[model samples]
Target chain A: MSTATQTMPSVERVVTPGKYTFGRIMPEALKYFIVITLAISYAFPLYWMISSALKDDPQVYRIPPVLVPNPAHWENFINAWKSDNFTLYTFNSVFRYAVPYTLFTLLSSSVVAYGFSRIRWPGRDKLFYLCIGTMLIPYTVTMVPLFIIFKHLRWVGTYLPMIVPALFGNAFFIFMLRQFFMTLPEELSEAARIDGASELGIFFRIILPLAKPALAVVALFAFMGTWNDYLGPLIYINKYTMYPLALGIQKLRAMMSQVGNAPLAYPYLMAVSTIAAAPIIIIFFFAQRTFIEGIALTGLKG
Target chain B: MAVATAKKWRLSKRETQNLITGLLFVSPWLLGFLLWTLYPLISSAYYSFTRYDLVRPPIWIGLDNFREIFTDDPRFWTVVYNTFYYVGISVPLGVVVAFLMASLLNTKLVLRSTFRAIFYIPSIVPAVCSAMVWLFIYNNQYGVINNLLRAAGQPIIPFLSSVEWAKPSLIVISLWAQGTAVVIFLAALQDVPRSLYEAATVDGANALHRFWHITIPMCSPIILYNLVMSLIGAFQTFLMPYLLTNGGPMASTEFYAMNLYRQAFEFFRMGKACALAWIMAIVVAILTAILFRTSGRWVFYGGGER
Candidate 1:
C-alpha cells in the first residue's frame, strides 16, 4: 500500500516532465509555497521562544518585536536557573520523577504485556480485556481517591505517590507493548522453550532482545509523560523544593509576580521554558522514526 | 488404563503450571489494577454520595452533592458550558486542521520529513512549557501576537484575561498540538491505494472530486478516531487553562477537569469533587458512545462496500 502510494507521484513526474505548462507549474509552485508558509507558521512559536529566551528586557518588548536578539544575552538562562533554584528542581525532576518513573513503568509494563501477548493461561484473554477496559475510565474518577489513599499512607508531599504507582504497570503502556509483542512470531518463543528454556528465560533471551524498538518507544513515552506531567506533581508534591521542572517552572512564573519585574521575568521565564523543553526536543529529533511508528501503531491499532 | 490415567494427570499438572506462570508474569498489572484503578473507581463512586472534606470523615449525604451540582451551583453550569464549548470547537477544528495538514504533506515535496518534524515537534513539548510559551505570546503589553497586530495597525486583544478571548485562546493552543492527529492522518493517507485515485482521474474526476470522494472516504476511519480521541482529550483539558489563566478572569476558562481539581485540592471539597468526576466520566462515555454509534453512517472499512 505504502510503496504504491509513494511511487505514484514520482511516476507522474516522469510522465509529464516535458509537458510542464503555466497551468501545471503554477499549482506546483503554489503548493510548495503554501506548505512552506504553513510549516513556518507552525514552527514560529518555537523559534520565538528560543529567540526570546536569549533576548534582554528591551529586546523582548521592542515595538515590532525583534525576530532575533542583537547581543543574545546568554546570561538570561543563568539568571533564570539561579532565580528559581532551578538547579535543584532539575535534579528533583530527573531523579525524583522522570528516571525512576520511566525505568519502573518500562520494566513492569513490558513484563505484564509479555504475559498478555505470549502466555497461554485460563481467563487470560478475559482478564486482558478487562485491563483494556480500564483505559476508558477517566483519570478524574481515580484522582481524588488515589490522593486520599496516598494521604492516608503519608505518601503525599513525597515522590512516593508519583513513583510508587509507576512500579505497577500503566494500562496504556501495557496495551501498547502487548500489541507490539503480538506482532512478533510465536514460533521463536516456542523454539526457545523446546531448548530447555523456562518462560522467563524465553522472555529474557528471545523476546526482550527482539523487542528493542518497541521497548525504546515505551521508554520514550514514559520519559515524556514523567517529564511533561504537571497535574500529578501538582496534586502530590506540596513542597516547592520537591517540585518537578513542570511545577517548578509554574511556581517560578507565579513568584515572578512577587518580584514585580514583568519585563525581566518574561525573558527569564522563557529561558526557563526553553531549558525545560530542550531534552524532549533533542530526543524527538534523534528518535523521530521510532516515535512516529509508535504513534501510528497506537492510533491505528487502538 | 493405568498409563493413560498417569498421562492425563501429567497433562493437567502442565496446564496448572501454565496458569501459574501467566499469573506470575501479569502479577504487577493485576496488583496495580486492584490497588490503584479498581479501588479508586469504587471508592470514588461511594464518595460521590457523601459529604467529605479532607479534614473530616465522609458523611453520607445521599444525592445532595448531585442535587447541588445540578440545581444550585451556577459555577457548575458555567464550567459545563465551558467544557462543552471547548470540546465542540477544538475537536472539530483540530480534526479539520490536522486533515488539511496531512493532505498537504502527503504530496511529493522536498524536505517533506523536515516539515513533518516541524509540525509534530510542538505536540511533544511538555504542556507546561507550551503553556508558558503561549503565555508570553499572548502577553497584552509586549506579546508576539500583540506586536504583530500593532504592526498591522490593529488593536491588541487581551487573550487570556478577557472572558470572550480566554476560551478561544485555549482552543487555539489545543489546535497547536494537533500534530499527533496529523501524523495519524498521514499514515492513513498513505494507506489509500494509488489505483483508487487513478481510477477516479480516468473517470474525469478533478483534484477536488478525488479528495472528496476517494481520499476523504478512505481516511474516514482515522478521521473518526482522531475526532473521538480529541473529544476525550478536550473534555479533560486542565493544565493549559490552569496554568495559563488559573481558570480565569472570571472562571471563563474553567474547564470541567480544572473545576474538579480545584474542588478536590484547593477547596478540599472531596465529596463534591468525586461527584463531579463521576458526572464528567458519564458525559465522556456517552459522548464517545454517540460518536461510535453515528460513525457507521460515514466510516468506511477497507473490505466493505461503500
Candidate 2:
C-alpha cells in the first residue's frame, strides 16, 4: 500500500509515434524540453557549491566565476575541518545529537506507539487523541518556557537542552509509528500473550523486528532534525566549544574571515558548508529507498 | 449516580491490571506532558501577561504586554507585515511550483528518479548550508550572479543588501527548499488513478480538463494538508533569514519568528516574547481553522466525508 516511490512506466512512455504531425509532436517535445530544463536548473546550485568549494581563494573572486576548479584545492576541506575546530563540532553533532536523539526517540516513541496501538485498555484512544493535540501547539508557545526551564536546570550550555527531549516521544513520530503498529494483525500479539509472553516481550521480539522501515523513518528524521537544529543551540549555547555543526559552521566562517584579515573567505566557507552537508547526503544516497518511502508515507498518510 | 455509571468507573481485577500495564508503557509521555508540554503551555500564557527578565522575578502587568505590542510597537507591525508578505508570496508560489514539479515528475520522463532526487536534495540539505550557498549566489558585488551581470555589462542587483530585494531574496531561498512539498504533491499526483485519466481521455477531455476535474478533485485533500503544513512552517520561518541576511538591509527581512527570537534572546524581553508567541499561536489557530472551514468548498474528497 505504501510503495510511494514505485515508478512504473506510464501509458505515455510507450506511445506509438505513428505519423509525426505538428499538433501531435509539439506538446510531447515541449513537455520533455521543459522537464529537462527544470531538472538541470534544480541541480545547478549544488553543482555550483561543489565547484566553488574546490577553487582557491582568488579563483572564487574571479569575474565570470570558475565552473570547475582547475587544480582542485582538496586541502580546503582539511583546512575547513581544522578551522574553528570543526573536528569538535562534527563530533558534537554525532555524539550530542544524531546517536542519542535517534536512539531515544525511536525507543520511547515506538514503545508509546505500541501502548497506544496494541493495548486495549480504557482511556487509550482518548489519551492518544490528547497526544496528537499537542502537535497543534506551536513551538513558539513552548520555546520561551523551555528555555526558562533549561536555564533553571543550568542546562543552557549543555547537550541536555536538546538531547534530553528525545527521551520523551514526539507526538508526530508516535502517531506515525502507531499507524504502523495498528496494521499488524491482532492475532499475532494475542498468540504471543496466550503463550505467556509479556507485552514488552511481544513488542521487542515480534513488533520491533517488523517495524524497521517505520522506525528508520522516525530515526533518520530525528537524526536530521538534531543535526540541522540551529535555533535551539543558538539560544542555549554561547560557548563556541559546545556548538554543533549547524551553529559551528557560522563560527567557522567568522574565524576564517578574521584569521586571514580578509572580509570573507568564500571558498573556505563553501568548503565547510560542503563538509557540513556531506553526512546527510551520504545517508540519503545509501538509504535512498527508505528515505523516499518515508517521505511518501508521511506525506500521504499525514 | 446510576448503577451503570458507577460500574463503568469500576473495572474487573484483570482489566485493572491491563490498565496498569498500559499506563506503565505510556508513563514517559504522561510525565513529559505534565513537565514539558502542559507546564510550558500554561506558563507561556501566564508569562505573556507579566514583565519578566530572567534575573528579576516576573512582575505581573495584565494585558500591558499585549497593549504595548498592539498600541505602541511599530517594529511589531513591520514584522507582521514582513511575515505576511513573505507568506503571501512564498506559500502559494511554492504550492504552484511544487504542483508543477510533481506533475512533470509524474510524467514518463527519462531518469525520473534521478530528476526527483535532484529536485529533492536542496530541501534536505541543512538550512545553514543552503542559506550560505545562497549568500554566495546573492552576494552583491563579488557574488556569482553579480559577477555574471558585470561580465555581461548588465546592471548588477543588490540581492540581500537592498530593502526592496532582501525579502524577495529570502523567498527565493525558500522556493529552493520546497522539495518536501513537491514530493508530497508528487505522491498525491501519482495516486491519481490512470483509469480516471483514461476515462476522461475517451470522453474527449483535454489535459487541462482532466487536471481541473479529475486530477484536482482527487488530490485536493492532499493539497489542503500540504497547504496548512506549509503555512504553519512559513509562519515560523527563522533559520534561513537568520543565517543568510540576519534580518538586515534595514531589517526588511525580520520575520515574525526572527523578531520573536530577538525579543527573547537579544532584548531579554521574555514577557514580550511570550506575548508575541501567544499572538502567533492565536493567529495560527485562527488561520488554520479558517482554512479547514473554507476548505469544504474547494477541497474535494474523492472519498465521501473527506
Candidate 3:
C-alpha cells in the first residue's frame, strides 16, 4: 500500500546524461549539494570554537579568519581548564545537579510515568492533565516564588533548591515517557504479573530493562538541562565554590575582562566550553540514532 | 440520605483497595503539585500585588504595579511592543523555512538521512556559543556576511549593532539554529500518507499544487504546534540579546524578559519583575488559547478524534 503511492513521483521527472541520468541524477546531485552545504554550515561554528580556543589571543580577530592553525597549541585547553576552575566547577555541577537529579528524576519520574501508563488507576487522566497543564505556566512565573520558598526553607545557596525539583518529576518528561510506555504491549507486564511478581518487582525487573531507550532519553535531557543551565545556578548558587560550570564560565569572562591586557585569553574559555560539552557530545555522537529518534518522539516537550 | 450512606458502605473492598493504590501511585505528583506548583503559583500572584524586594517584607501596593506598567514606565509598553514585533515576524518565517527544508529533505532522494541530520545539527551547539558565532558573522568590519555582500555588489549593513536590524539579525541566527523544529517537521512529514499526493497527481495536479494543497494541509497540525510554541519561545527570549546587545544601542533589543530580568536581578525590584512575568505569562496563555481555537479550522490530525 505504501510502496505504490511512493513510486508515483518517480515517473514524471525526466532522465539525464551519463552518471547523472535524468531519472535519478538530478535528485542525487541536489541532495548531495544541499547536504554538503548544510553540514558545513552546521559544523563550521563548532569547528571555529575549537580553532579559536587554540589560536593565540593576538590571532583571535584576524581578518578573513584562518580555518586551521599551523602549529596547534594544546596548552590553550590546559590553561582554560585551570583558569576556569572547571575541575571544581564541573565536580560541583555533577554533584549539585547530575548526581542528585539523575538518581532522583529517573527513579521517581519513571515510576510515575509507568503507573500512569500501565495502571487502571481512577482519576489518572485528570491527574495527568493537571500535571500537563503546568507546562503552560511559563518558567518565569515559577522562578521568583520558588526562590522565595527555597529561601524560607534555608535551601537557597544550597544544592537543594536546584536538586529538589527532581523529586516532583517533571510534567513533560512524565508525559513523554508515559506515551512511550502506552505503546508497549500490556501482555508482557500481564505475563509478569501472572508469574507472581509484585507491581514494584515488575517495575524494577521487567519494565525498566525494556524502557532503557526512554530512560536514556530522559537522562541525556536531564544532564544537558542541568549542565547548560545558567539562570538557575545564577539565582540559587551564591558562594563562589558552590558555582557550577555555567556560572563559573561567566565569572571567568568577567574576571578576564577586568584584568587589562592579560592576553584576553579566550582560547582557554573556548577550551573549557568544549571540555564542559565533551561528555554530552561524545555520548550524542555514539547515540545519535536513539537521541534523534527520542527527540522526534518527545517533540521537544521541555 | 440513608440509601446513599448504605450504597457508600456497600462499595466492594477490592475496589476501595484499588482506589487507595491509585492514589498511592500518583501521590508523588500530587504532593509536589500542592507543595511546589500550586503554592508557588499562588505565592507569585500575591507577590505581584506587593512591593517586595527580597530584603524587606512585601508592602501592599494594590494595583500600583499594573498601573505603573501601563502609564508611568516609559519603556514597559515599548518592550512589550518590541516583543510582539519579534514574535510576529520570527514565528512565521521560522515555520516557512523549516517547512521548506523538511519538504526538500523528505524525499526518495539519495542520502536523505544524511541531509536531514545536517539540517538538524545546529541545535546541538550551545545557545550562547551559537549567539557569539553569529555576533562575529554580523560584524560590520571584515565579517564574512558583509564581505559576501560586498562581493555581490550590495551595501555593507550593520547587522546586530543597528537598532532597526538587531531583532532581524537575531531572527537570522534563530533560523540557523532551528534544528529542533526542522527535525520535528521532518518527522511529521514522514507520517504524511503518500497516497494523498499520488491521488492528487493522478487528478492532473502539478507538484507545486499538490504540495500546496495536500502536503501543507496534512502538516498543518505540526505547523500550528510549532507556531504556538515558537511564539511563546520567541517572546521569552533572553540570553542572546542580553549577551550580544546588553539591551544596548539605545535599548533597541530590550526585550520584555530582559527588562524583567534587569528589574528583578539588577535593580532588585522583585515585585515588579513578578508582575512583568505574570503579565507575560497571561499574554502567552491568551495567545495560545486563541491558537488552539483557530487550529481546528486548519490543523488536520491523522489519528486523534475530531
Query: What are the TM-scores, per candidate, against the unseen true structure?
Result: 0.94, 0.95, 0.89
Candidate 2 Cα outliers beyond 4 Å, as residue runs: A1-17, A257-264, B1-15, B304-306
The DockQ ranking, best first, is 2, 1, 3
* Model 1 Cα shift for residue B165 (angstroms): 1.3
Separate DockQ for every predicted complex: 0.59, 0.60, 0.35
* Residue B228 accuracy (lDDT) in model 2: 87
The local lDDT score (0 to 100) that residue B24 gets in candidate 2 is 87
What is the C-alpha lDDT profile of model 3 across B116-234, one tens digit per residue? Answer: 66566567655655555555567685456676677677888988788889888877777777877887777767766667777776788876798788788877877887887788888
Cα lDDT, all candidates: 0.87, 0.85, 0.75
lDDT of 1 by residue, A114-221 (tens): 999898887899999998888878888899999999999999999898888888998889988898788788899888888889999888888999888888999999
Question: Candidate 1, residues B90-205: lDDT per residue as tens digits?
Answer: 99988998999988888777887899999999999988889888999999988988998998899999999999999999888888877899888887787777788888778888
- Model 3 alpha-carbon drift over 4 Å, by segment: A1-35, A194-196, A260-264, A300-302, B1-11, B135-157, B303-306
How far out, in Å, is residue A156 in model 3? Answer: 1.8
Q: Rank the candidates by lDDT, best first.
A: 1, 2, 3
Docking level for model 2: medium
Query: Residue by residue across B95-196, what tens digits does model 2's lDDT show?
Result: 889988888888777787888898898988888888778888898867888999998989999998899999998888788788888888887887777788
Worst ten in a row by lDDT for model 3 chain B:
B125-134
Query: Which window of ten consecutive residues has the lowest lDDT sum in model 3 chain A?
Result: A1-10
Worst 10 residues of 1 chain A by lDDT: A5-14
Candidate 3 RMSD to the real structure: 4.5
